[model samples]
Target: MTHSASPFVPDPSRYIKRSSREVPVGPVTIGGGSPVVLQSMLTSDTLNTEACVREALDLVEAGCELVRITAPTVKDAANLRAIREELRRRSCPVPLVADIHFKPEAAMEAAQWVDKVRINPGNYADRKKFVVRSYTDAEYASAVEQLEDSFLPLVELCLRRGIALRIGTNHGSLSDRILNRYGDTPLGMVESALEYARICRKAGFHRIVFSMKASNPRIMISAYRRLVATLQELGPDWNYPVHLGVTEAGDGEDGRVKSAVGIGALLADGIGDTIRVSLTEDSVREIPVAKALRSLVEQFATAPRPRDRIVPPFDPFSFQRRESHRWDRNPTVGGGEPVRVAVLEENLAALEAASAGTEIVPELGYQPRLVEEVDPEDSAALTALGGGPPRLVTIRDGCPYPPLYAFRMLAARIPAHHPILLKDTFFPGEEGDPLRSLLNSALQLGALLCDGIGDAILLRGEADPRKALELSYNILQATGNRSFKADFVACPSCGRTLFHLQETTARIRKATGHLKGVKIAVMGCIVNGPGEMADADFGYVGGAPGKVNLYVGKKAVRFNIPQEQAVDSLISLIAGEGKWVEPPSS
Candidate 1:
């Protein structure tokens, strides 16, 4: 049943936490087999000491282990002293981290006050004008030398101050140097951080954490796996703790589903040390979602084992949907078809009632009488169906293997023509608790979807039929398997945001939520804007206070539109591009 294993993951079959070297952040310890740490960032302006202090206190009260404040300028960075002093005066001892971008001066100023400094390797030294040009070997080496000149001092400062450094890289913001070489890929994201890691190692600095973030879960997951695999290849000392997140994960259920899929999938593979569920809302609201996600992953511990050695059927670092011929044409499944959604027979009416005006509705309902169920561990049972005519088959619940491994086993043994139906639960447990139910379904089903295993998904456990239907489509959207509504990639607000992100996001969503298949990105500032919104069809970004910048793909097409007209302008941009359709009127 098995041959070789991927160096990226030791065993993709179960939840065995990956071992990492412990790095200290003030009073908290990350990695070294420690329980996963929870962290969140402040949305208040750094210049406003009282607001920053208040938000920090709220996050700390909500059980956040680490609090990050953005420092977009030297003034903002210097203001961290006042915020830190106030927190200390209040007797709050939570570790503080300064989020820095494109400013070594700010990072240097921040080091004096905070417990940790997070630097984006993509923009820390390199300017991202989105320039593309090939470099000769000598030219590339010179760029590296200059980068070290600017970055090595920070490494020395962190070492001297006895503080930790996180060389975080965002998939949307990789440097032009990396993009020219590796393209905008997970490999590029990994190498961007590795360059800084090499600098830290050369300078004998060991207190470090690493993160690979993206708005897309597939890219985020792949970057982290490639990074860890690269570290493993670098030898024993490169096991720095990892911080998992999916950046700009919109708000509400969409935000939760995306965060759960991205963070929960990696946790399922045993790969996170710390996590932040980035949402476009109040910072404190993110903590419980993070905790719920951790709790949901804990359930993976109860997963049953496979009868034999399980061989991975898909690449862990890249997404290439598994091939299976479509058995039905109208509501397609497999062989390059959009992943379909299904509901239980009894809940079909509720699903329809719940999805009255929504474009994303269930394509099928599970009729147990028509579909044959097979236990994954029963090899003879799977073999028996191989010679039969193509039909819709579903895996049995309460199997020896969890759905993640169960589906893998089934896919490995069965013929490609038979379409597989995926269910949220592989075993029955408690019935209530919608939050845990959403997290569990996202983790289990999303993990399989990311691995390119599921053809159609049936969400059980969630008692609200409408909520379950929404979760099903949201899971598919988050996994990049399908999109039935306007796709949004929004950043959680920080000190750098120029406008009210929460209100702006809500307004923009109201205007464009009806536009099916349009990918829109709403960013707070330039730091995570242009590049982060690379995959979006239209972008609404903060250019300055009371102003917005609009983009078509990665190129900025409109600038300095008053924030009052931004949503309308975005609609016009979409309309002008022929993506706009009249919203249904009551």
Candidate 2:
């Protein structure tokens, strides 16, 4: 039956055009243009065939199109065969995928019993411990060649029997040769697996799936992006089903969040063909999360809709109406002027010293004020006075109230037009859940509290504070507010720094501290300093102890200042260039 000509359309058929080389795994057609299937493995022991079968049935109900069972030994393979038979007899619908490691004999055995076989190339080449204490390079190669010969028989068996193959690459198990060639990157994983795919294809096998699993979400996302781009470049006909997964995603909340971010990003981008959320705990629960992710992607289909005039739902971040009058009005004071900013110091002496040469206006636009101190009458009067409402309000620590709950209450009481900023407070005993819950709640409230928000987000161990600040600034800047300061991109110096970069940066910051809208970068090494600091308005880079390269944008303006005087020299340069000025006192 022609898919488009049919009156009844299958939901999966709506996304993927049916393919000639399709592999049907239960209700899901893998190779044919079908919505990529989400699959997971049963963590239950295969030795207990009843438990394994029961788990498979549960996963099927949970929307797992395919389920994998581990067969580590000959005994395990026997149990897996029995489970498959039991499920088949009971008329269970989900296809079973057998996962085998190291032992090609076990894989060969499981191939006859399961619908698909998942093999790790690294495991195929593994030498048994009892073989030999002194095998020559040629002898080792001969052993591998023999193993490859044995493995091909299993591959051929699967192909001849119409069983699918998945060349699964785990981050931990990548061969040292591939690592040496491609530096343990996603490219290496793809290249390694493609080589295996070539072997399968050469043996007259076209039914295949590929997966590269990583615990790090960023690395996983990057690898998948690169792989998809590479496949597209290879040509349209080269398309094959790609399985997405964040492997070793720790059990519970951490795993859920990590899997969601990694899987969600790829699904949103229209790349993944299948997904697996590999949590360390019971595999049964993971099926729901994986199915939910696929459902989320279906809602974001990039395929052009049938009607031209149909208006879809607006994505909160991307949608902005030109007719909204708020965009035209100058919503900030100082005629929408940018505010000068400085990191606060506890010492009043240093604070006074930093503010010495800068003009401190009584009210410069929407300064962040303590929420507890702001009177209700004053808040009302400010609205009555009306030259744009205050932008930020810091919730003081130890204020005898939950900041988020209090903010919600305050938001209800405040004038509709006024927006308040809720600052993230650092507490000794606070955990991530409360902070995440509060932040998510605040985001949901929209523009009622502020145009946008900022957090003094702290990082753990060794990360550059400047990089953290830049990331935070980018997030806030994306909100379309112009009153923010230029980001300070500085690196935390290590023993490698030729100059005392940290102290020098502090001094330069002290000198031009009053300049709010200017971005200054302080970097340790010249190698990545210029490139990394390309986004900054100005940069100071260390060359040697007592020497600095001053940059305005990307160009180097001056170099070779005395070690002790480098900070002053950069400051003088800023002042001479009219980038620094005195501030009015309170």
Candidate 3:
């Protein structure tokens, strides 16, 4: 069968624009329009060349696009070289990256054989000169010069050998100058790595990758997002391949969750070029997790495209088909009609008043009177109120006691015989210590509550009450639940804040009240807005009192929209795009 030119067209402009350099890591192309790659490092002793090679091969076999091995000493560097030769001789085609520290000779040796070299700028200080001379301005300059010279040889070797370089900066080992200037922040990490990248570029080596590793996943996520945004602001033409990871990600389940949240968020935003799951266990075990993460990203994420591209037309037929399937399966929406709404509340007068202007049919029931209160007879009434099992439940604030206790009680009271839906609640408390402790406790309690009980969990933060709600909705959807309400998550601005955050957030919430399952975050400043609010479906960040930056799902959609109209504009955009639907009627 001969193929003909069809209606489908692959637009060049739709491709994410990247630097046109050959990424030297295996089949993975980093600084180009290739798929984002997944990589991991081997924890095996580098001095044992055969063991390192075996781990590398295992990682490659497990779908790792690249692998890194540590060369801690000259002997380890020699072993690394031997491993490279063995791979070449055995026709094992995976690319190897050599991670080096203070030993510049080892770095130089590895650069000659490996595809890439990772150097920590902090650890690369010239200790030889520091030991030899007393502290002085002259001595400091000489030390810096000596350090530069040491790296220069490796840089030269890499340049000649066509090896890519990665200036990997870590939070724990930040250079004194960077830490002093920018504090131990994401911006500081970016500055330090960029400074090193500039030095490498000036030395006639341009193939570079960068990573800012932090033990805190949230910080890591924020740092990378800021770095990417900053780079874009500097110039669209300025692009660098990035290596992503959550440093010291611990071991086992906790590490996996942390790594997933950090790496997954970046991948969702089209920011990560490569990933490493930096677990405390044998790093080779991280390879499979890295591959799994990449697969998850490819499966669930929206593909990245250049800003210039006209977005492809959405397939309305597919959407309609999905809705049709849902409607058919839902017994409440018989005859292909929308489901009826039912209100379930204990305060009959308040419920009546709240439902007065709405089309909902009122169903009066006794709400649980206390934490341990339960009535088996209420199950049928609750089901009827929701027209089946509720897909979502909202727990009010001002609980009589600790919120976690209330949640547990509610979870226990809900009937176990039916498909009882999950619930999200708003808990009011002060910020910082109390809220953090509350959230941590809630998570632990939630784990118990969710044991074969609920489908999703949401912890409401007092910083922005609406944001807590929105986060609940997103978390539900992310966990495969099909129902929720819109929530807005806004932050309290400080002295460095750029806009009238409080007023703007209130106005946005009021303006977007009609939409359900939508999430909007109005952040006080641009620095933390993008990263801290990564989970938001829609975000309005303060640029100035009258201006704000708008984002949808990690991608900046517009900038400097009028603060008064930003919320309305976002609502209009969501409606026009038809990306979401009304909550199903009970």
Candidate 4:
């Protein structure tokens, strides 16, 4: 049955509906069967009204339906009124969302000025110091009661001001109390937001959306899935809209691919209502990526629910690489190996033409043909004419349809077990920016890779062959499917960062750029360092003024080392662990 976008109506449908309550952020409706909306954030300083307005307008013009600005203090939040007024004067009326992390007063003040306010549950009332403490049941109850007492005013203010609220939880920013109980896991992330959500619900504050963001796609996807599953247990009334994002995803191809993997995986499960492709780049650059993802969801998401499809046996809540017992023809195609990249060769002439200019690596294969329309006799024809089995089955794009949707629909009709190549074709927009094409390619193909689908990626269009090859590898590495070079996890710094994160990250990258297959994280402070770098092999974190804390995984192996000597110490730690290799000649 269909659901209405009204607070009084209950959404009972699964999959597309996600059984979530409807919330209105300005004129845009989220959850309760509403179409997924697109959003992005302004990176400029909030106090800089001129810069913030320009960036926000750019984001809006680029198709961002909702724009968020950070308000770290009372005054910073007050300036939100100026930003909103200026946008109105300039003829852009996009809804504004104020991002609040540590200040409750700012949340209260921000609510009066913007259309929406987003509060981080981890730091709204408490700062984390990794302290360990034990609490009696009475004491725990008392602490929660105090928090509710404090949070009730803000909830009441939102109700009076007609503003929406988002209880956003970041994977790396969970407080010590949460860690003490849940151990920095996805369950902990969900509980952090639920604590605030339960408070809002108790106070009749239902104009809410929730987000579980993380830098690691695997962790982010798992946390959101766990959030939905937990909410499902609480019954139909608890399903609020979820805002999907991969926070602090780094620049260019890396950023786009990482965001796609997390956001797309969730959207594929029909779990998200609004999406923000959180790239550490220009705010306007994020809009196209967000729209592309929205388009993908609209194109492929079926009404009867993809649940009916004969999907491969795999768990969505946990990270499990897709597996197969045997390949029918291509014996080396499946059975749990790192995915291989292949080039699509349609006809013999096209293959000959491409081979003349393309670098033919010894390992790369050129598939002969791709079947689009399935005929009743096609299986019989294949069996009768087959000799040694098709090396790889390819799904190509000859029409305007999305390659991914085509891939899925065609693959479902074929065998239950066979490695398929997802051949995504791309053409630059009217602007002729090759970067846009690259972003779209990653948005479409990266989604499949993140879900453990697609055996190979074949890029087609007018871009340079060398660039295509590099981008293919980058997409694979970004999605955690494969890696061939140094992977760096650097935080997007805020007011809390103690050092120059950009320059220091560059310095660390220069010294360790040669260590292939090694993952390094450079964090500005302890706030997001330890938890955000959950997957990094080693971490370089700012501990205090001019001092650094180096970590092997999440454990601080060396504490309080001088800033000048920190890089050397990190190297030593890596070398000590036998994971570092000497750099070749400069």
Candidate number achieving the greatest TM-score relative to the actual structure: 1
Regions more than 4 Å wrong, model 4: 1-21, 31-35, 85-92, 131-143, 301-308, 326-331, 344-362, 369-420, 425-440, 454-463, 493-510, 524-527, 540-579
By TM-score, how accurate is candidate 4?
0.78
User: Across residues 481-558, which tens digit of lDDT does each residue of candidate 3 receive?
Assistant: 323334454443332346655466556655664466676666655543554453568777776667878777656788
Q: Higher-lDDT candidate among 2 and 4?
A: 4
Give the per-residue lDDT of model 2 (tens digit) for 1-586.
0012211111211132222246655456775657768788875667877888888888888778888887767778767778988988989857888877667888888888788888876556552221224556676456546656766888799877888888887553555555544545667777767767766777888788777766545556556655655665566655667778866454444355556656665555455677787654556777767766666556445333321111111111222211111212233322223321222222224434554543321122222342223422245633442445443333334433233233333333443333343432324234444324322222221111121222122111112323223322322322223224333555433223456544665566566655667767776646325544534677787776667788787677888777677677777777777887664353
TM-scores of all models?
Answer: 0.96, 0.50, 0.50, 0.78
Q: Is candidate 2 or candidate 4 better by TM-score?
A: 4
- C-alpha lDDT of candidate 3 relative to the true structure: 0.54
Candidate 3: segments with Cα more than 4 A from true spot: 1-22, 126-147, 300-586
Query: What does candidate 3 score on TM?
Result: 0.50
lDDT of each: 0.86, 0.53, 0.54, 0.71
* Ranked candidates (lDDT, high to low): 1, 4, 3, 2
Candidate 4 lDDT over residue span 1-586, tens digit each: 1112222112211224466778888878878788888888776778889988998888777888998888878999999999999999998889999988778998888888998998877888866776888767787677778778878898999999888999999987887778778878898999989888999988888998999998878788878878887887788788788999988676656777787778876776677999988664556877888887776666545433222333323344555554433343432555566666554333324444554633232124454433222321245633432344433555433434455444544444455355566665523223445554665577567756665666666765325555566677777877787777778777655444567666787778788866877888888677667867767899999999799999988888899999999988888998999988877653
Clashes of each: 1, 14, 6, 0
